[model samples]
Each structure stands twice: as structure tokens, then as C-alpha cells.
Target: MRILLVGAGLSGAVIGRTLAQAGHDCHVIDSRDHAGGNCHTERDAATGVMMHVYGPHIFHTDDAEVWDYVNRFADFLPFQNRVKTTSRGAVYSLPVNLLTINQFFRRTLRPDEARAFLECQADTSIADPQNFEEQALRFVGPDLYEAFFKGYTEKQWGCDPRNLPASILRRLPVRFNYDDNYFFHRFQGMPREGYTAMIRAILDHPGIATDLNTPYDPAMAGQYDHVFWSGPLDGFFGYRLGRLGYRTLDFERFDYDGDYQGCAVMNYGDREVPYTRITEHKHFSPWETHERSVCYREFSRAAGPDDIPYYPIRLVREKALLEDYVRLAQATPGVTFVGRLGTYRYLDMDVTIREALDTGRDFLARAAQGRSPAAFVHAPL
Candidate 1:
């Protein structure tokens, strides 16, 4: 079998490696000059610091298999994400932990009291919350929602929360305890070398041939027995169903001698602030020390034609557009759409890798039995 992978990101690399290992000839192509897609990382030319090209992607996952698989490619240093947000002229711990609650409200509320207080602030009338705003209001209430989520989310999605779907907020963790570890996963770390090194190792299989800055087209699609597309779903059909909505980021870099924000990530939770968050790249790798630090002010906006799509909007209209693309995907034989853009969803790095692995396994299973792989591992919602 000849397999053609449409993108050289985690999904494409993993899928290609899996098929190639099974004696299939795999050809991987990516539009970017690099292999790791948005997760691509490289050492800063002058500083020798590992720079996360797209942004800081901390690999955090509870799945033992996923963690072990990733570790096989590159050494991973144990790192937990501790995030903070500045709102209403004050800085507070994030993920709505007990300490953040107590400190933000200026009251030492117990676990139960804090939970109850949050409920008191919620809008009880919204039984079935539809949009992001309503969902936040129902879950955390007006004060906390406005303080932490409203402005940041608006900037992130490039729209009022009312325009976005409720599912987006479901990823946010709300805890009553003082635990401030951003992710609840058991394994949390960044690659010791960098993500690009890990990806290069993953695609090191003998049967896989990589072509960066090459876009796969219909003429090229038929050259392979099967295709595992990790690019935008609409791009496969040439946007016959119209382009899906996405939120992309614009980073403004700054140099500092010492600590800038005192943390890796800091959300600017006021509407007045233009950027959503500021990331101190040096803090992401605390194992090494550098006198000069680098920070980026992350501005989120609606993805334009030439911009790289980041977060899937998945708004009502976008969902309708996505359904059309999914229908086309299902009808279009010999191709399986996987990963964030292919499935049209916002996914963490761990989840994307997990799903890609699952997709690879399913693809091989289907090929062995002479069947078509399912259009998706999980349903598009």
C-alpha cells in the first residue's frame, strides 16, 4: 500500500510512521518548511534556547501509552503548567482554584464556601446554556466570569462569548481545592531537546519519505493507495463548502534581562488590553538558565485567508459548514481526515497525538481486513 500524508505535523508523522512500519510506502508532505506543524521547535540561533515556534506546547497527558510513546522519540523533562491571570488591576492564580478564589475575593472561603459562593454568583435562569458567555455565567457567575473568562475568551475567539459555543468552555477546569497545576494529567513535561527533535525522530522510519513545503493535491492524492489528511478539511475539497472559521494568534516578541511576567503564561483579563496573554519562553524550560529572557504578547484574531488557523471556531454557522465538509469527507473515498483541522476542533497536543495514534491503528486494522477506515475517530460536534 502507498500512503500519502497531507501534513507533516504530529498526526501526519505518526500516521506515516505507523503505515511505513507495516511495509507500506509512506510519503509525507507539509506546506511549511518544517515538519512539526505548529508544534515545531528549534534552538534560538544566538541564545541556544529551545524556541517553540508556534507557542509553548507543554506535553501533558495521563495516558501511560501516549507518554511512553512520545518519550521514545525524545527525552522529556517533567514540567507542570502553573498559569496566572491579571484582572481588575490585580494578579491571581488561574484555573479558578481555591487560593485564586480566596485571594481574588479577599476572603478566606473554605472549599465548600468557595464552591457555594461561586454558585451564588451564577445565573440560575439559563438552564441550557448555548454560547460561551451563558455557559460561563451559569458555571462561575458574573464576577468571576467577567474577571477571568470574558475578556480573555473574547480576545482568544475574536468575538463576544455569546457568539461562541458552550463546548469550548468545557475544557476549562474549575476546582474548589488550592491545587493550581494547570493540567490535571499525571504526566506533564516539555521535550528536553525540543518538539522538532522529537518529531524528526518519529519520522525517522526507513519507509517514510518527507517533503516539507509541498502541498498535496488531487493529482498527487491518487499516486498513493490511501491518504491520511491532517490539513484543513475544507482545503481537501478546495473550499466547495466554504472556509471554516478559525482563530489565529499574532505574537509580538520582546527581550528582557530577567523575569517578565514571573510565570510562563499570564492572561490579560481586561477588555482594555489588546493581547490575550503574555508568555515568557524562558520560563517554559526552567532546567536551563539564561540572562536574557524572551517574552511574546499573544494577540488572537479571526484567521484570515493566508494565516495559519489555530482554534476552530465551531460556532453555529461554522458547525453547519463543518457538517457539509464531513459529508464530503465521508463521500470522498480512500481518504481519512484526522487531527484538529481535519476534524475541525480545538485540541490539546496530547489529545491530538492520542487520536492520531488511534487513527493509525484503525487504518492499519482496516487495511489488513480490506476495508475503509472510519471518517473520524470521534464524531464532529
Candidate 2:
């Protein structure tokens, strides 16, 4: 079978590799000059530090299979994401941990005491929290919400927390203990070399042919047996209905002689701060040391026509539009929608890899059984 894999990110690379290994001729194409999509990384010519060009992407997953699969390509150094935030001229541990709670309130409270204290602070008026604001108020009360989440959420999504979904706040943790680790996943690390190198290795199979800086043309789909699209779902259909909403990022680069921020990531909780967070590239790879450091201050905003889409703002309007695209995708033949942009969801690296693997396996199995595969292995809707 001749398979065309669009977008040479993890999704396309993994799927292409799998199908190629199964004796299928796989052709991968990416509009960008490089592979790894948003997870693209390169070394700074000046500092010799591995720079996460787009933004910081820490590979944290609990799936053992996914962990082992990535390890086969590149060595992953043990890295924990310990994030800090600045609010009202004070610095505090992120995720609103026990230490953050104690420091913010200027009191020493034990686990039980802290839990009770937060409960007291929590608003009991709202029995059913509908939006992000209400969820934050109900979970951690007014003070903590305003200090940690409100401004940050507004800047990150470019909208008031009241307008956002409650599920967004659910992803953030408010620990009663002093554990400052951002993610609670079993496997957490950054690739020793970089994400691009790992992806390049994945696409190095004998049966796979890669074409960088090449955009997908509808005509090319006719030549292939199947198409696995990892690009934007709306883009595949030419955005006839409307472009789905997305929050894109802008990075402000700066250099420092030595340590900058002294941490991998630092969030600015105050609304006065323009950017969401500042990430030091050197801190991401603590194993290597450099005399100078490179950092980026990330600013989030609504994605324009030319801008790269980052977070999918799946509000009510966007969801309705996405459903229409999904219908079109299902009706369309010889194309399988895969990955974050294809599925029109905000997915982590592990989820993207796992789904891509599943798509590959299902396609091979169905073809062997003399049946056509579905448009989506895992339905976007």
C-alpha cells in the first residue's frame, strides 16, 4: 500500500514508521522546513544550548509502552518540571501547593489544617460550577484564584475565566502537600538530544520517504492508497465553515550571562505582566552547563491567518464548527484524521503518539482483512 502521511510531527512520524515497517511504502510531507512540528528543537549557535524553538515541551507520561518507544530513539534525561510564579511582588511555588498556601497566607498549616482552611475559604454558594472562574472559586476560594489562576488564565487564553470551560481548571492541581512537581506522571523527562532528532530517527526507516518544506496537495492524495492527516482539520476542508479558534504563542528572546530565573519555567500570575511565562533553555537540560543562557518570554494571543496555532480554544462555537468538519471528514474517503490539529483537541505528546500507533495498527489489520479503515481510528467528535 502507498500511504501519504501529512505533517512530519510525532503523529506522522510514528504512523509512517509503523506502516513502513509493515512493508507499506510511506511518504511523509511537512510544510515546515523541519520535522517535529510544534515540538521542534535546535541548538543555539551562540550558547550551544539545546533550544526549544516553539516552546517548552516536557515529555511526561504514565504509559509504559509510550515511554519505552521514545527511549529507543534518543536518550531521555530525568527532569522534573518545578514551576514558580510571581504575584504581587512575591514568588511562590506553583500548583498552589501547601508551601504556596502557607507562604501566601503567612501561616504554617499542616495537611489537615490546610485542607480545612481551604474549605473555609471556598465558596459554598455555587453548588454547580459551570465555568473556569466558578470552578477555581469553589476549589481554592477567591484569594488563591485571583492570585494564581485568574490573570494567568486570562492572558493564556485571552479571555475571562468565566467564559472558559470548567474542565480547563480541572487539569491544574491544588495539592495540600508540599510536592511542587507540576505533573504526577510516572515518566517525566526531556530528550537528551532534542525532539527533532528523535523524530528524524523515527522517519529514518527504509520504506519511508520524507519531503520537508512540502505542503499537502489534494491531488497528491489521489496517488496514495490512504492519507493520515496531522494538520488542522478545518484546513483539510479549506475552512469553508469558519476557522476554528486557537490561542497562539509569541516568544520574546533574551540572553543572560549566567542563570536567568534559576528555573526551567516561571509563570507571571499578575495581569500586569504581559507574557504568560518565561522559560530558560539551559534549565530544561540540567545535565549540560553553559557560560551564557537563552530564554523566551511567551505571550499568548488569538491566532491570525499566518500565525501557527497552539492551543485549541474549543468553546461552544468552535465545537459546533469542529463537528461540521468531522462530518465532512467521515464523508471524505481515503483520509484518516490523526493527532492534535487533526482531531481538533489539546492533546499531550503521549496521547498523540498512542493514538497514532493505534491508527497505524488498525489500518494494517483492516487492510489485511480486506476492509477499508475508518476516517478516524478514534473519533474526534
Candidate 3:
């Protein structure tokens, strides 16, 4: 069968590769001149450092199958995301670990003591938290929330923390131990040749054909037996319902002769700083050495029609509108919504790849049984 994949990012590439191996003709298309979407990485001309063109993308997951799958294409190098945050004129370790807690309070406390201390600081009155702010206050109290989360959350989302859902904060872990590692995933690493090269390798197959700078037109869908829409869900329908809220990022690039931040990512917890974080690209690829450095100051704002959407702002109003679009997608035929933008949710690199693999396998199974795949393999809501 002939398949059309819109947006040649991880989702489309993995799914297309899967179908191609199954004796299906898969055509992958991307509007951008390059593939890999946000995970696109290229070497800096001046510094010779492998810069994360969009932003820093650390591949971390507990899924062994997903880890092995990525490793099959690129050499997986050991990489743990150790994040730092500057707040109120002081730098602190992220994830609000024991070291951060002790440093902020100007006291050395054991793990058990710190845990008890944190409980005391929390506002236990609010038993059931509704929003990000409340959840922060309930877990870490006002001081930690103001210093560590409040300003950063507001800057990242471009809204008050209360305006966001509680699930956002619930997903973030607060550590009582001194582990400064950002993620708890068992397998974490960066690709040796960069994400773009890895993606290229994924698309390098006889049954797979790729076209860069190729935008997906509605008419193109009619030419294929099936379509995988990895682009924005509302975009597929031309925003007929309404534009779902999304936050876009702007990266301000600058080059330095020496190491910039000494770390891959340094987030600014102060809203007054304008930009949320500063990323030193060289640190992302630690094995390589370069005297010259490249860095970016990342700024997040409400997405415009022309801007590249980053985070999905799934507030109450957006959820209602999303429901309307989901209904429309369900009624539509011969197209399946896949990945972050397609499903309209914030997805990690691992989750996106895992879903794409599952979606592809499901499609193959259904096709074998003389059936068409569903509009969504996984529920967006």
C-alpha cells in the first residue's frame, strides 16, 4: 500500500520506516528544508560544535525496546541531564533536591530531616490542588514555589500558574535525596552523530522516499492509500474550528571563545530575566572538545500563525476546542493523527517514538486483517 506521512519528524520517520519494512511504499514530507523537526542538530560554522538547532533534546526513557531501537541507528553515548536554575541572585540544583533545599535554607539537613522540613513548609490545608500554583504550594510551600517554580512556570507558559492544570506539577518529582539528575529514566543518552543524522539513517531504506521542504497539501492525502498526519491537528483542517493555544520559542544565538555555562542547560527562575534558560551547545556533546562555544537564550511566548508551535496550552477553553477538533478528526477518513502536534499534547522524544512505533504496528496488523487504522491509536485526552 502507498502511505503519505506529513512532517518528517521522529513520529513520521519511525512509522514510515516500520511500514517500509513491511513492504509498503512510504513517502515522508517535511515543510522545513531539513528533517528531524525540533530535534534537528547541526555543527556550528564558527565553533565547530554540534548545536541543537531547535533546542537541547536529551533522549531518556525507561522503555528498553525504545532505547534499543534508537541505538540501532546511532551510537548512544552516556548522557545525564543535570539541570541548574538561577533564582533570586543565587544558583541552585534543579528538581528541588536535598542540596537545593539545604542551600536555599542555609542549613545542612539529612534526607529524612529535609523531607519533614518540606512537609512543614507546605500548606497542608489545600488537600486537593487544582492548578500548578496550588500543587507547588501544597508540596513545596510558598518560598520554594516563588524561588524555584513560580517565575519559571509563568515565563515558560506565558500565563499565571493557576491558569494551568495541576497535572503539570504532579508530573514533576521533588527529590529528598541529593540526586541532581533531571530525569528518573533508566536509559538516557545523546546520539553520537546528532538527531538529524540518526533520522536520516532511519529514512534510508528502499521502500522509503523523503522530500524536504515539501509542505503537505490536503490534495496530497487523496493520492495515498492511507495518511499519517504528524503535523498540527488543527493545521490539517486549516483551523476551521479554532487555533489551539501553543507556546513558541525564540532562540537568540551567540558565540563565545570559551565554555559559556559549564553545563548543557541553566534555567533562569526569575521572570525578570525575560528568557527562560541559556543553553551551551558544546556541553550537550561532552565527548568532543572545542575551545570556542555556542549558546542560545531561549524565550517562550504565545504562538502566532507563522511561528513554530512548541508547548500545547491545554487550558479549559483549549480543551473544549480540542474536543470539537477531535470529533471532526474522528468523522474524517483515511488519515491518522500521530505525535505531539497531531495529538495536541506535550510529548517527550521517547514517548513520541514509542507511540509512532505502536501506531505503525497497529496499522500493519489492521491492514493484514483487511481493515483500516483508526483516526487515533492513542486517545489525545
Cα lDDT tens digits, model 1, 159-244, are 77888778888889789998999998899999988888899999999999999888777898768888888888898888886999
lDDT of 2 by residue, 1-381 (tens): 999999999999999999999999999999999999999999999999999999999999999999999999999999999999989999999888999999999989999999999999999898999999999999899999999999999999998899999999999989999999999999999999999999999999999999999998999998999999999999998988899999999999999999988999999999989999999999999999899999999999999978999999999999998888899999998999999999998999999999988999999999999998889998877
lDDT score for candidate 2 against the true structure:
0.94
Top lDDT model: 2
Give lDDT: candidate 2, residue 249: 97
Q: Model 2: how large is the Cα RMSD against the reference?
A: 0.7
Candidate 1 pairs with clashing backbones: none
lDDT of each: 0.87, 0.94, 0.94
The reply for model 3, stretches above 4 Å from the true place, is none
Across 36-84, the per-residue lDDT of candidate 3 in tens digits comes to: 9999999888888998999999999999999999999999899999999
Question: Candidates 1 and 3: which is better by TM-score?
Answer: 3
